[model samples]
Structure formats: structure tokens, C-alpha cells
Target: MFKAYRFVFIAIIACFALTQCTSVPKRTQTPQERPDVQQQTLDLEDAKSSADWLEEAWQAPNDIAKNSALVQAALTLQDEKEWQKSAAILARLDKNQLTNDANRYFRLAKGRWYAHNQQWPQVYKTLEGLPEQFTQKEYKRLTLELLAFAAGERHQYWQALAWQVEAQRYSDEPSPNALWQTASQVTQSQLPAERPRDLVLAGWWRLIDNHHQAMTSPSAFSALLDNWQNSFPNHPARERVNSWVSSDSQSNEVDKSTNTIIAVLLPLSGQYEAQGLAVRDGIIAKVSETKSYELVFIDTHQLSFEEQQSKLEELKPAGVIGPLLKGSVTEWVRQTSLNTPQVFLNQIDADTSEATANSHSIFFALNPETEAEQASEFMSSASSRTKRPLVLAANTPGSQRMVERYKESWSGINEPSVSLFSQRDDMKSAVEASLGLVGSKERIRAVKIAAGKIIVDEQERSRRDISGIYLPGNLQQVRLLKPFIDVSISPFAERIPVYGTSSAHELTNQLGDNDLNGLIFSETPWLVQNGGQNVLLNQWLDARSGWELSQARLAAMGYDSVDLLQRLPIMQRMPGTHWKGLSGVLSVENQVVNRQLQWAAFKNGSITVLEEQPNAGKNNR
Candidate 1:
């Protein structure tokens, strides 16, 4: 649920887990521009780290101080990424033997641990027992924030906001920073739970961060503020925004080095010439001939892969961006020596890539593999008792590739039991055979054979093991498959949900409405029915004619590619940072720019927002 801010969320939890933890990674800030997180950093740095605390607890003679030391030691251990060590220390504590602060501290520490492991129910139970008020004001505020975070993970945004509001007031930190921190903690799925409140908070963050933009485009900023204030008559952050504006005109630049030219390699001629042109246009739309960045485009059309590499060196650009084909991406990764930092616009096949081991190259793509990965994450994280997902897809080369990629991504992130099946010509037999479900005609004959002795009717079992189905197929196949899946799965089981992809468009085609109901999938924001829209984006799309709209995905891939150049420096500095961009919530890990997508489902006639609004409460001004 806390997708965009994964590393941030966990680090924040670790920051306060131990009174004695010293290595907790908090956001560093100058005192003049510091957020509420500064206080935690100051306090933690003054205390001993987990190792010191653990040793002190082992040596301390007094029982009261001993328990106190133990609690601190456990939390400190957690902050240091030593989960087993923390758990071992926790096992030594006897809650009944502790009193006052020690007892409360233990519960809070455990609550943090639950959050670390995503044990949401345990997080709530452990934290709910604390007193309504605390003797230490800072601890009280921290506790409330943790509660809000836990609630968010549980898809309880309303409750999260309640806690966040209280926490914000109680916090001895700047109002704007407190507000931003709280909003960041709210899970994406639960964003719309308090729409106006979230809008105001998000607007303030954008206002503060885009100080240069606000100064340059005062009218646009003012109109944005007016809309926000008018929409929520009494938002708490509305007044805070007025103070956020600064007269300073200097821009916030993401400085890398003196190297300024960026070489872009794409198919300027050949079969993919059209796609390359679209991407080029999108990049051009975002970037101007600014003093900061110079751009050069190299045609990958007539050149061999080695020649393309030679051309890249000739330009000697600061960073390279392009080569929209997957084959180029794979070769780029396998190169033993890379001269400059180059970003590939496509993802390589997993069988060929060891991206984690690669260097000086980045891969970003609107790949179906990424969509399949997100589907697996959504099914696992969504708060259902169901743990088994029967992944069924059409038995085609592309579908099979997507399925493997899905399994790879899913297996890497979660531990849920998953089964795979494929359908070709016969949907019914395929569905039944996949689940190992019994066929009636054969069973009837078996019953007839056993008539004299005994007949085991077996009650026509439904494999209760299957919680959902993943069908990555087109509309025709999906329409044919859904009814068969419904009949083949046992009636005793919960309604088996099917997760699909953009391959299955919810819009009415030859296969008409509502047939493939309850199919969930991730698509580009603009493609989805209830996606958070941007007027600027719409206008940009309208400006282009012919096939740009039809090839929107490839175009966006180009658009976001250029935008990523500036953000990469910031992301490199802060590993977990994310920002709202054209594609989706964009974040970088291991030099690869990842687009965290929005989820939707097919209902009555069209696809609607199923979980979170990816761009809702986002900064569009």
C-alpha cells in the first residue's frame, strides 16, 4: 500500500523504534528548512546505537534499568536492519514484569516491528492499549503518527487522517512539514478517503517545492490555490500555503557535473521510425534548449549495435537517453565497460538481464512485464483472507512471457501460493483441467461401475485453495474464459477474481458489456476511465493529431524519459524519493526509473478506479 514511499516509510518507523538507536536514517535538513523529522534525528543521534544498548542491557545490574535497556536494544536492533536480533531481544522481555514507561515502550516497539513486517492487525492491537495521553509529548505525537501509518496500510485512510490531524497538532514541528509527512504516510489506496484534506496537503507540498515555478507563473499558482481553497472551505493546510511562498527567484537545480550534452539514440529511420519520432516529440515537448541541458539525437537506423556504441562515444554527452528497443537494452547491460550514463527506454528480457549487477545504464519501459508484476503485488497486499491466486493466461508466446515475468516479480515480493494454467482452443476443458477439478460425465460412469459396492459422490468439490485467477488475455479470450472459470471453480470458494491487462479493454467491442466483470489490471493513467486527469496533459494530447493518441504509451515513454534526467540526480541522492510525473508516480532504484501505476477494474460498462487515484491530490499546476 505504501508503494511510492516504501524505503521512506520503513526508515521512518526505524527512526523512532529505539530510544537508543543511533544509525536511524532520517531526512537531513538545515535548521532553517528542517521538517518535524529533525527532532527525531537529533534525539536518536544523542543516544547509543543498538550494539551499545544491547551490551549495556546485558551488563546492567538493576532490573528496572535492565528492562529499559532491553527494550531500547531491541528497537535499536530493528533500526539497524537486524530483525532476528530485535526479535530475540523482544522474546526476553516479560510485559507483565515491566511497569510505567517500560511497559508502554515495549508495546510501541512491537508495534513498529509489526509495521516493518506488514503485520497490520498486530500493529493495531499492540498500539491500541497505550494511554490516551503520554507523559512525553514527542512520544505521544510519534505514537499517533505510527497509528496513522498502520491504519493507512490497512486501507483505513479516514482513521489515518484522524490520527494524522491529532499528530500534526501535537508535533513540535513546522505545520507544513508535519502535514506533508502525514500525507506521505497515507497509503495510495486510501487517498480518496479524505479527498479535500488530501488535495490541500498535496497542493501545499507542490507550492513549497516548486518555489521557482510559483514565482515564474504566479497567476497559475494563485489560480491553483484559489481552486484548492474554494474546493475545501476550511482545509487546515490552506492558510499554511500562504506562508510557503517566497520571493526568491533562483531555481532548484539537480546538479550532476559540467558535462552538459545528452545524446539520445532512437530509430530515426527503419520499422520503428514512427515510435522513435513520437518519443522524440514527447521529449521535445518537455525540454527546451535550456542553459542547463543540451540534447543530441543519434539515429540507430543504419548502424550496427557496435556502431551505435561508437556514435554514443562520438557525442561525448554527459548522459545518454534512448535506444527504444529491448535488444539494445540487453546489449547495453552486457557491455563490460560503459563510457557515460545512458538510459534505455525499454526493459530487457529477464532471462538476459542481471540489472542489479549492471552499471552506468538505466532501463525504463511501459512494459507488460511491469503491469503483471503490479497485479501480483496488488492481489497479495489487498486485505483479503485469500492467499492463493490461480494465474490463468492464453497460451500464446506474448502471454506466456508476461506470465513468467509476473511470477518472477510476484515471487520476489511476496510468499503467496501461486498456480499457473493456460487456455488454447478449448476454454472449458482448459479451466477445469488447470484446477484439477472433476469432470461430471466420467464421474457418473465411475459411479455406475461402483453401483453394487459403494459410490463416492464426493459432493463435486471446488478447490477452495484458489483465491483468485489472473487472466492476461484479450477481450474475446477473456469473455470466453470468465464463464468457464466461474463454472470450473467450486461454488464453496469465494468469487474467484480475475486480474487482466490492457490487452482486455473494458470498452464494448465484439464481446459486449459486463461479461468480464471484476477483472482488475493496471493501465496508464490517461487510458483508465476514472484516472486522475490533468488539463495540461489533455491539451497536450489534443495538440497532436493522427496516431499519437493511438500510440500514447510509446509517446509517454518518451515524454517521461526526458523529464527523468533532472530527477535522476535527486533520486540518486535520496534513494526512495518519488514525484508525480506524466507516466505515474515515478521513482528510481538502481538507476532504473520505475512507474508506479494506478489500478482499475471493469464493472457495468467501463473500467473504473479500483484502488487508489495515482494522480489525485497530485501537484498539476
Candidate 2:
């Protein structure tokens, strides 16, 4: 059943895979050994603008002078925080051509440029090796600050805290609030068993541990804060402990008592009735065991504006949820007082919210962007050498939006190669073109014409630089896409990792999903499980022959929505609080719920849930 080309390619690739990559290292040279430009001092104040400096650099008489002018221009741009422009100018100047002072300054500018691009690893790589003594006081300060920021962004919490403390030598005292936020995402296991040698960092570790233990109880948390203040008297966070207590005390203001009445608003009688019903069922299922709260469903589509307003006034519920349509959500916010804490089921843009703007409500849209964002993060954090990836999406509005979101979240320097296929017949060609196999074939044809024989030494190949392939397509498209991708890859090339979005997965027979083998995709935990509520839901759906993956996902969202109403207050107060809901690991920040979904892969025509790994990005291989 295997193709002859695959067998031939496998034999060739196996040999190549065993061959280790070798690099020719270049000898390092110091600035003093390269250039003697001490006599030619450059004055940055002489230039009015970066453009003036760039023009001056272009007209300089010597390489040293030209490099000096370029450094000044880059510095000017850095001071202005124009990172992209500064990076472009820095790219033009050779480091070897500059004096020691200019070279040191160039390193700082380059570090800032990498930081601006959100390339945290590159930022550390560029700046971590720099000398202790910088050319200017502000330069040293900025370097430390950038290192701290880069470390924090990379989730190197301890390093970030250390760098921040170091930066305080030149700047104001390091921000305890910033450090607290940095530690929010870190778990207890991440904390060292042995206390950090640095007293300041140790105090921070203790504070995080105490906060995590007592977060569920305001009284316990208040007592712990007092204890933390007494124990760490000279700690930077000691002053902020009282404010945290105040914040925790304020959280108690949100009513947490049982038997509270909550109103639900959803479209139950219109075009989107099915979606509304599924979500409603999920909510109902989640709350069935709990008798503390009363649910009141308001059909937004069935009621007129006046009728809905009157109904809400009569019910006077503790909190409201729904208005699933984007337009309805916008309209509801604009028209109502929104005094009651509400959770809208959809997201609205700033332009849409300008008229109806209310900050009290939370938006919990099942956005495709969330899946795309997580996928991007997964690929960026993965150990694969693929800096350049091919992103394949269908010629559809949803797929286009997802592709755009993925691009926005991508961390690499090179933009992903995107291939949009409109027709089923064109999918193979699109994949081949994106992976540069077409060019490989063209080269093979050229070789055959010149040699006047089929050359055994030369082989058709996929681009070696492609680290991976990301297919953000629907179930059918992804099924087709995986095979095309498998065939397009060259035998001499390393096996490229393939990733997909939730749309690529469905509950189907193992044989039906054979094409999806080796494809890793993101999906809700509810669909991947075999027991508990999933089992019950499966049995019920199977009895009625009404199981649909998309509807089940909607149901999971509804279930999480109900759970979130109770957890939202706790999450808002505790920054990194996470609730394990069927939809995902739900967390909230700035009134928006974020879902960290589970990753699953097809193995031998069956789906297997990937165990979450530490910094491993899901055992992607």
C-alpha cells in the first residue's frame, strides 16, 4: 500500500537524518583590533533627525565614519522607541567597522530591536553576552531593563526578578507590583525546593506561595498578607501587602451567597436557535446538581426591546448572561444601565462598543482566534528548528481570519508562508508550492535536460528550511491536506511537523480518520474524554443519534459559561486563577475569558490526548 517513491525517499532521508549538521565557526575580533577611529569622534547632537544621520552616514568619507553615523541614527531611533527603523539602520552597519563605544551602543540598540519584535530568545541571545560596562549610564540601565523584560516575557521569572533588581541601581526601585504579576503564571512546583539565595527573590517566592494558598478565602488571605508583612519587613512588596488586602476585601463585595437568581439571555426562536439551545443545554447540565441558584431564560429573539427591558426589570436578577448575537450584545449594552454584572456571549470591537460602552460586562466569545493564538504559541515554543513554517488555510472567511490571527501571534523573525486553497483539486498544488516542491521538480527537469538522462544522484525535494506545516482548515480539508503534505515532503528532507486547529477534528470511525494520522490538532477536553460527564453526554447523544462535534463544543462553552459566572470574581481578584471546565482551562484577564485547550493527535487512525509537558510544546514529534 505504500508508494515506491516513499520507500526510496525514506531510505535516503534515514541516511541524511543520521548525519549531524556542522557549522564553520568564525573567529571573534575586538573593536580595537579592527579599527582605530579614536581621532574621529561623532557628535549625535549635530544631526536634527535620524534621516539627517542616515544621510550623513551615506556621505561619510571612511567606513569608520559611516558606521559611526549609522550608530548615531540607530541611537536616535532607539531613544524615540522606533524599534523597526532602528533595527533597519543597525542591520546596515558592520559591527567590525565601529569603535568600541559605538559597538557597545549598537548591541543595546540591537537588543531593543529584538525585544520590540517579541523575539524574547533572540533578545537574551544578543544582550546576555554584552560587557558589564556600557558606553552610557542610560545604556546600561536600558540594557538591564530590556533583559528583565525579555526574561519575564519568556517566563524566566527568577531571572526577570534578578535583572529588574539590578536595573534599580540606575533607575527607581524595582516595582513589586510588576514582580507580583510576573509570578502570577508560575505554579508552586516551579518554585525551588531550596529557597533562593537572594533575599529579595526569596521574599517574593514566599509571597507567591502564601497568596496561592489563601486566595480562596479572604480572611485567610488577609491574615497571610499580615504575616508576610511581619516576616519580610524590608521586602519591596511589604508596602503593597496592605493594598492587596484591600483588593481582596473589595472582592468580598461581589455577592457569593447561594440561592441567588441569575438571568440568561439567548436567541431561542430564530435562525441561530440550534446554537442557542445547545449552549442552554450545557448550562442546564452544569447547574443540575446545584440548587443554590435559580435560572431564568429570556429568549432575546422572541422578545421586543421594550418587552425584554420590562422582563429584566421584573426579574431583577443578581447577574445576567447572554445576548449571543454580536449586534444584540452591542445594542443591549447601549440601551441598558448594565448595573447588574453581565457576561455577553460574543465579542465586539472598539468601533462597535463606542456607542454602547460598558466595562461591567464580560465578553466570552468562542472565538476561532483563541485556537489560532494557542496554536501559534505552541509552534513558537516548540523545539523544532523550523523558523519558517507553511500556513495552509481554505479560501473561506473563517480560515482567513484564523490565518491573520496566527500571523499576528507568531514570534519568529520570518513571516509564515501562507497557502490558500479554494478548490479540492488545487490543494495538492498549493501545498507543493508552499513547501517549494514545485521548484524542486523544475530543478530536476533542468538537470535532466542538461544531462540528457535521468540522474540517479539528484532527487526532487521539499524546501529544507520549512520547520513545520500548519493547516487551519475544516475536517475534510485537513484530511486531504495531511496526505498532500506527506507526499510533498522530500525523502532527503527531515520530517516536517504538521499542526492543525480544532476545525480539523471530529468524532468519526478510526478507518474514516486514517488520513488524519500523525496530525496534531487543538480541541476541547469534553470531546477527547471517555468517562464522567462526557460518557453521560455520549450515551444520551448516541441514543438519539444526534451527536455533532460542533454542537458538543457549543454545549461545552455553555457549561463553562455557567461555571465562569461563579469563578469570574475569584479570577478577577487572583490574576492567574484557572478553572478546569469542559471547554478548556478557563482564566480571565481584563474581563475577557481565556481558554487554554487540550492538544490531541491522530495515532494509527485513533485520537490520543497529549499529556501536557513542561516547556515541551505538546510532544509535537
Candidate 3:
């Protein structure tokens, strides 16, 4: 209903502005010799005075500047904050007669008045005209500043920043450095050592902004809050974070030892039922051999918050996984205590205070931040050996973030690395440019010869030193890049080893036999065999009747997640060490989960293990 009202309000404003007006004429100077120039000048002054008088009169509209007076006179009533009278007068204005500058000034004035009244939509509408008609720097600066303030009031920080930056760029006046210094000093002033909700909110806001800037992960932000809690133990936010951490720790212990009741809370009867079933199967298969587990399923389809709470209370499971939709998670978190450990299949909305409070209890299914960190660590280590690590990424937003993370991680290690970029349309050219073979027939001929003398010579030169290439793109995009790699090392495919992520699993399917030969990179445990001795896991895989792709990895993660529960203390102590799990080696540090990536090279149309050791290096290239 609120959404509908907002739409209706927008439509009404659109109609009022667009239908009641015609374009104003461009401003032009009136000649002194023109006919009726004297009369026109006198009338203009009279109009201006009347407008000002009406504005003043509107302060007490009942006493003066009544409806029967001139339209300009009625508009003057607005100066007294008589908005209704001002609107009526503005409706009667001859837009065609008003000079462009006057029209703009009037609109800006109206916008400021609306903003002052907290009429955000109206303010937005009125300010829209000022941009097109006003050229004065002062007016532009004022309008932008006011608009930015209005946007900030509306909690539209990004939009506010855009206008604020524009205003600052145009304003020629010197900055108020003294005022800023005074404010900074005030902010730094010591206060009574009491926890304030406002302070917590401010800290959260700063953390969120930093997260957006790619300065830290969500977990890092949570950890910061955790530290704050330690300082002010009684603070509500602090209590919440502590409770969450405690709950997760408790749940992990329960899942490991006793015949644990693991509840799957998801929209099982509705849209995501199939996915829920898949997850259920994965969990079931993982715990089939263990006598210490039980799977309890709860359908979240169309359930209200109260119903969800009741259902969860009734189940009383050791751990809960899901409530897949973000909205459901928010509702559930708001009404329930963080007693049971929870694993969120997706990120909970950061706006929900309850969700943030209970974040310690929840673990995201796919943490891009963790993935980026691990990838960087791996690349850094590989780069140390190769001397030159080349980072390549597509022009997409996701790929760009991945590349930025890689660069950041690389920067932290104080390592030298080169970044390469390829656009979807210019992949061929970008690849050639990166290889430093941009515009030469010799290079072109060398790539074309499959096993010829030229190709062999080029291959030998390339093999003298092995260079690591990091490609952050989808499997399909990576596959397109493979042709370039093949071309670059046509004669020496065996000699030049290529490295990539687990995403390369898909690309492996796309390659021809032996095309990816000598390709080596880290992947999850399920993708490789660490001595190949999981008889039960193999039996389960063979007996399962669905897709055979990466199911093994999921099964391994499930098994590992459950198995690691009992060994949490030991795991936490040596987080960098390898844990022989179904997926690969599992590692955890500071509560951040890291996988001991299994490196493999393409061999005989399958991946062959190259290295199964934990990534021991300090730098992830």
C-alpha cells in the first residue's frame, strides 16, 4: 500500500508539472528604444515589488495577500511559510512571459521551500528544472547543495554524495578548514565512558562504508563489532555478537558428538523446494555413516514470522541451515534468539539490525571475500616461483572486483605484479597485447604453426621461464581465453603450465582431449583424490542418481563441515595446516574458513593431482 501511494504521488507530481506548463522563452535584453519600453520597465518593477510584498504578506495570509489579489501578490505570501497561497499563485504565473533566469530562480526557490518543509518528492521535482535553465554558478551551487541535503535526509547517501561532489567542484570559495578542524576536535573530545547506541550505529555505518570500498570483508566488520563488544560487554550490540559466536560454537560441538538433530529450514513446499531437497540429500549422504545425526526438515513456504518461530521452537534442533530467502531470514532473526547455529545459503540483508546482531550465528554459503583472499594467497605463492605473475580479468563487474581483490592482496605482500584486461569483443587483441606480440607477422605465423619450427622456437623461448596467469571470469569466458593461450604456446603446450580456479571445472569440459594438458591450479577437495581412499563416499556417489559434476565436492563439504565440528579447537589452533577432507584440505584461521586447495594438471582427458599440500606461503599472488 505504501508503494502504491508512492507511485500515485509520483504520477500526480508528474502530471501537475508537465501538463500545466509551456516552455519559457530564452532570456533576451530589451532595447531602450523599443516601443512601450518605459511602461514595460515600470510594470516589471511593480511586479517585482508586488511579488515581494505578497511574500511578506503570506506570513499572515488572513490579514493580507488574500486570494482576490494579483497572482504575484499571492506568491509573496509564501515568504511567510503560507505554502497553500504560494502554490495557488505559482499556478497562475505566465511561464511564457517569465525570463528563463526568473523561471529558474522561482523553481529553485520552490525547491528550497519544499526541502525546508520536508517534502522530498516535491523538492526533487522543483530542482529538476533548475539544472536545465540556470547557468549562474551561485544558483547551481546552491541548488546542488540543497538537493544533496534533501537526498541525505532521504537516506540516499550515494545520490547525496554525487550532488555534494558536484557542488564542491563548482564552488570557487575557499573551504572552511577552521570549521572542519573545530568539528574534528569536538568529535575527538572524550566523553563519559558509557556505551551509546548512536556510537554503535556510527561504527556500523563506517564499517559498511569500508566494506563497500573493498577495505574489508563482512566477517572483518563483524569481528570489529566483536572487539567493541569486548570493550563494552553490556552493550546490546556487543551482547548480540557474543551470543551469536557462542551459539555457533555450541552448535558445532553438538553436531560433532551426540546424535544431533540438524534442522533444514527452507522454502521446501514453494519455489525453492527442489533446491532444498538437493541440500537435504547432500546432508543425508554426508551423515549416512555416522550414528550421531538426524535430519529434520521444515517448510518455510508462505509461513508467517510467528509460525516460523513456533516451528523452529518446536523442532529444537542443534543446528539450522537456511530459510533461503533473505526476507524470511530477516523475519526469523527478528523474532528468534540466536541459540541454534545457522548457516545462511545467501547473505542476509545488512539493513536488518536483527540479522546483523545475529551474524555470528550465521555463515554465508559462498563467501566471495574468502574466495578472493584464498585465490590471492595462491597466486602470490605461485608468483614467487614464476617471478612474473600476470593477472587477467574480463570487463564485467564481478570479474573486476575479483581482480581488484587480487591486486589488493598482492599489494599487501609488497610483491610486483602486472595486471592485464580483456574486453569480450577484444579478447584476441588484448591477449596478443599482454604477450607483447601485438603487431608482428612472425608472432602471427608462430601461433598458427601447430608443430612447426617457428612454433617450437617460440615455445622454447616462452618455456625458459614459467609465467603465472590469473584469469577471473566465468568458465565460458575463460574457455574463450584458452584459444589465445593455445596460440601463444602452440608448439610448447606441454612446457607452459597454466593455472586457474575451480571455475575451470566447467572449462575443462569445454576443452578437447589433451587441450588443457599441463594446466595446473588449486581446487576444492571433491574435485581431486587425496590418496583416493574414501570407499563409503565413492559408494554413495555411484549409488546417487543425479548429476555427477561437482556433487562429490558438495558431499565432501557437508561431511567436512559436520566432521570439523568435533575438532574445532584443534582446527582453530592450526588453521593453516591441511585437514584431509572429502573436498580437499580444510583450513580455518581467525574464524575465516580457508580450503587447502588441491592443485591438478590435465592428463588423459582428466585432472591429475600436481600438489596436495596446504598453501604454505605468506603471499597469495
Candidate 4:
């Protein structure tokens, strides 16, 4: 009779059910179930307090009252949230002293204690394969409820739903809201192969959410229910839907904005104005390709940070994106109070990665660290026979950043990587040092000095321990650095494969890139897909050149940002889905956007995309 109201109290646990239970096991009895002991428990109508029960257990060893009073004390402890003490009270009791019913009570209580402490796996293990008779009839309903809650936490949503439904029929412990939440998690955690079952569950949740309509107007709800039943006639939820027994108040009131209005926080007039404008153009270009969304552009230079913030509040958009610099992104995340989902154009450092976790935001930085890590994984998988690698980098800030990240990526190798910063004062010497050639030559000179004579061994050569090279720099630098590496290691090692990031070269200038022959690297679709020849993309690229990140590539980045916003819901709803955009094959997880890049190489002086490692596209991360 109280099932309908039971869910309203799920958040407020009921201690009375626990404290008042004196249930005995149903199927069997033992020495403890003797008539005298049963009568002793019932006779204690004005029983001593839980403390007095504890005293009775120790003072009256074999007394029948001792066994009965101890059970009461455990219940009293459980009611007070002294879960460990409650379980301990049962554990210390003698197995021989417990009747079959008493044993059942102790096991069920211990299992419930684990659930209360969120030790879900322990709860499952404790309750697994227990006979139906093990749980007293009066306690079975709550046991089933605890089992269901634990199942949901472990992602066994199907089993969780089944257990919860059975529990609700016995006693609606987890209300419709809690049950519906379990259903939604099941949907998100489901496999793509399970889409049919997922949809059926989704339909059931829809019916549950419309419970008010089902009750207020039976005919209308019946029609909807009938349509639902027709779609999934064999669905387990059919009976629940047909019953029309649910509360509309149980449905979630989470924000469901379509995100029609977007407030952009990019610099349109200042130092970063060019890049910001390029991104804005890309955002604008996507307007015709998909759903209509209003873009409100606020130039960072024209408006003060506070003024920009004030304008954001004034517009009250469904989403916010930008503040490209790391510092701006940091401040905005710290102070922003808006509840809508916001995408920052930069990544927060380790400290900020944790801080933004609670905010309605995600990091979408163009971080090379992720790229470097993936590159390491790719190269490591590509070959182990080619000798350990050499890392040659320029002295500029960007080059150093890439080299540092590369060092982090390759930190696991037993054969140490030779990393050297080129002063550009002498590229040849730098490459030789990176290959250990300089060290080898210096050793030979030291040996000569020690002997006080000059003796050259004809077979002696520079150290040949390396197999490949990783150089991250501009196209000009790569063109200049590759040959030095090739010649420096010629005597001792064969010219190994040279790898680079996409930023190292412009594949569009095929004529000038003849010098980049044999270079292997990863590329976004924008660079690999015929120079992103789509007419709409070209138009935006033409107008936005020389803007912040004036390169057409940055313009492509701008375009992807907008397209990603529009498809956010689809990606979230079906997490396994991928959007093959200009940037890469994009996917979203834990709020961060991920890209699966393609491999390419300069073949015969013209770029050729590699089909050698088909499985390499998926990120190991």
C-alpha cells in the first residue's frame, strides 16, 4: 500500500524497518529455534536497551536470552549507522549457537552492511548463490533492493533493472526516479551492437516520464503505451508500461537547452584578432551546413574582460566558446557562473585539469602533448628493429616545446633517446651529437692522447645504435635537418625513416616539398583530403588568411569547432559515434574532444596517405 510513496523516502533511509525486524528464517530451524528461546524473545516485551543486550550476551553464556538479545543489539547498531559494529556483532557469535534462521539473518545483515559502505563487489560476492530460504521472508524485499543498487554501480544495468523491478513489486524501495536513472545509465554504457535493446529501454523511460498524463487521461496514455508495446512486444518493461503506475514528479528536471544562441569570446581586434577572426569565420561558414545557431562575436580588445563578461551575461547564450589563451581560459573557468556547457579553446595545466572538473566546461586545446604521445605509440608499434631513435630539435620555443613533449612520450624506452637542441649555428654538428657521433669521435681522440700517438682504425665508425629520427619543426627546418642526419649516420648506420608532426610541412606545396621526400608523419583530414577542397571551406580560407593562426589550417580548425558544437548531442548520446571532420575523425569522452589521425608520407616527392597500418587510427589512450 505504501509502495507509491516509498520512493519519496529513498534519499532518506528508513531505519524503522531495520530496527524493528525480529524475523526468523522461513525454511528451517536449529537449536536456537527451540520453543523456550522463541518464547524468551517474545516475552521481552519491555526488552532491555541495545547496551543491556550486549551485556546480556557476555554475562549469560549459554542462556537462551543471550542469543536472542544479541540479534536485537546488531539491529540497534545498524539503525545508528554503526555498520562495522553491526557486522562484528554477528561475526563474533558462535556458528553452533546460531539456528538455521539465525545464520540466514547474520549473512543477509553482513551483505547489507557492505552495500551501505558502497563496497558493491563484496555485496555481490556475499549474496551470490544464496538460497531463497536463506533470507527471511520479512527481510527478502530489502535484500533484493540492496542487490539492485549494487548492480547498477557495477554497470550491470540489465541485472540491476531486473532486481529493482522485482524489489519494487515486493516493496518500492528505489522509487521510479532512481529506477529511471539506472535505465539511462544502461543506455549510455550499452554497446552499439545493443542499440535495439537500448532503444526499447529508452522507450520505457519515456513512458515512465509521462506518468502524469497516463493517470490524468487514461485513454491518451493507453494509446501511447500500446504504440510502445507494439514496437518492443517482447520487452521486459512491457508489463510496467501497461500498468501505467509511475509518478511524473519522478522525472528529471535537468537542463535541455537546444543551444541555439552561442556567445563567442575571441579576440577580434587585438594581438590574437587574426586567429580569432579566422575561427569566427569558420563558425559562420558552418551556419549554412547544419542547424541554425546565432553567433554573438565579442572582440577581446574592444571590450574589457569584465565588459566581455557583462556582455556574455547580457546575451545569456545557450553555450560559450573561446578566450583562446591559456590565461584567459583559466580566469574564465575560475569565475564563470553560467550553468550551460562551455568549451575552452586551450587546455588547463595539471592543476587546472582538476579544477575545471566540477565546472560545466571541457578542455579543447590544440595540445601537441596528446599528438606526441600518440606519435610515440604509433612509432613504437611501427618498428622495434630499426635501432633506438634520435631527436633533433631547433632552439625556438615551439621546437623546444615539441621536443620536451616528445621526451615525455618516449620516456619508457630502455635504449635512451638522443635529444639535442640545434643552435642553427651548425645543423650538421647538432645532428651528429644527437646520433652520438660527436661522443664517439671525442672518445677516439681521448684514447690517442692517452697513448701519446695517433693511430686510426680503418674499420672504426660513428656509433650505429639508432634506427629512426623524430624532428619537429617548420618545413624549411625539416628540409635542412633531414640530410644532415642522413649523412652524419651514413658510415655507421643506414639512413633510417624520419618522422615529424603535421606542423613540420605543408603538403599543399608539392613542388617545393621535393626536399621532404621519405618523411613520414600524421595529418589531419584538412591537409590530407585534397587540401580540404570543399568549396565552402575554400571561401572562408580565402578571406581569413593572415588572421591569428592566419594559415588555412587554423581556419579549418575554426570550422571544426562550430561543427562539433552542433553534433555534441549526437556524440554524447551515442559515445561510440565518430564525426569525420576536417580536423580528424572526432569523438567526445569525459567532455574532452578526441581525434583519430591518419598517417601519410612524402612518396616520390608527392604526399601519399599510408594504408599500411589500418588499425593504427584508433588511439590507444
Best by lDDT: 2
- Clashing pairs for model 1 are 462-490
**Decoy 2 TM-score against native:** 0.70
Q: Which digits, one per residue and each the tens of the lDDT, describe model 1 over residues 1-621?
A: 234234433443454455344433322112222223212321443768986775666566566776888788776666667765676567667898887778887887787666665566777888874637476665677677677766765656546656776677665563654454444333333444332445545454343333323333433554555555565555666555444322111121223353677788888899998888878877776666344677778888777888877876666566778788888777767763654556679877664337545444667887777788777666655424434567777667878787787666552222444334454566776677656665654675678787856755655555565555777777678778888877776676556667777666532321224676666666666555334244544565666655534366666677777656655444432223565665677776656677887677766655567665332111211
TM-score list, all predictions: 0.55, 0.70, 0.48, 0.56
Determine which window of 10 residues in candidate 1 has minimal summed lDDT: 245-254
Q: What total of clashing residue pairs does each candidate reach?
A: 1, 2, 13, 4
Model 3, which residues run further than 4 Å from truth? Answer: 1-259, 267-274, 301-306, 323-335, 345-364, 384-386, 411-425, 439-466, 489-496, 507-513, 530-552, 564-579, 587-592, 612-621
Model 3 clash number: 13
Per-residue lDDT tens digits for candidate 3, residues 380-475, read 554434355566677767776777776666522334344455467787667666655544446656576855654333332232233466666656
- Best TM-score among the predictions, by candidate number: 2
Candidate 4 local distance difference test against the native: 0.59
TM-score of 3: 0.48
Per-residue lDDT, model 4, residue 167, is: 60
Ranking of candidates on lDDT, top first: 2, 1, 4, 3
List the candidates ranked by TM-score, beginning with the highest.
Answer: 2, 4, 1, 3
Give candidate 1's total backbone clashes: 1
Among all windows of 10 consecutive residues in model 2, the one with the lowest summed lDDT is 31-40
Q: Can you write out model 2's per-residue Cα lDDT over 1-621, one digit (the tens) per residue?
A: 135434433543353334324222222212111111111122334445776776666566666766777787777766665545565566556788789877887887777666655556777988995638675545666777778777766667666766766665665445666666666655554666777778887887787777556544423756777788888899877767767668656745755652277888888988988888888888888778676678899898899877887888877676778878898877776788856667788877654345234545677888888898888777766634445767998889988999999888876545688889888999988988988878988887787788885555566687877766788887888878888889888876677889888787665632225677778788888877641236666764675365577777888888888767765544655555677788898776666778899887777767777896323222342
Where does model 2 exceed 4 Å of error? 1-147, 162-207, 214-259, 351-360, 383-387, 453-459, 509-512, 530-534, 543-545, 612-621
- Candidate 1 regions exceeding 4 Å error are 1-94, 97-263, 284-296, 304-320, 330-342, 348-361, 394-401, 408-423, 439-461, 474-479, 489-494, 506-518, 529-550, 575-582, 609-621
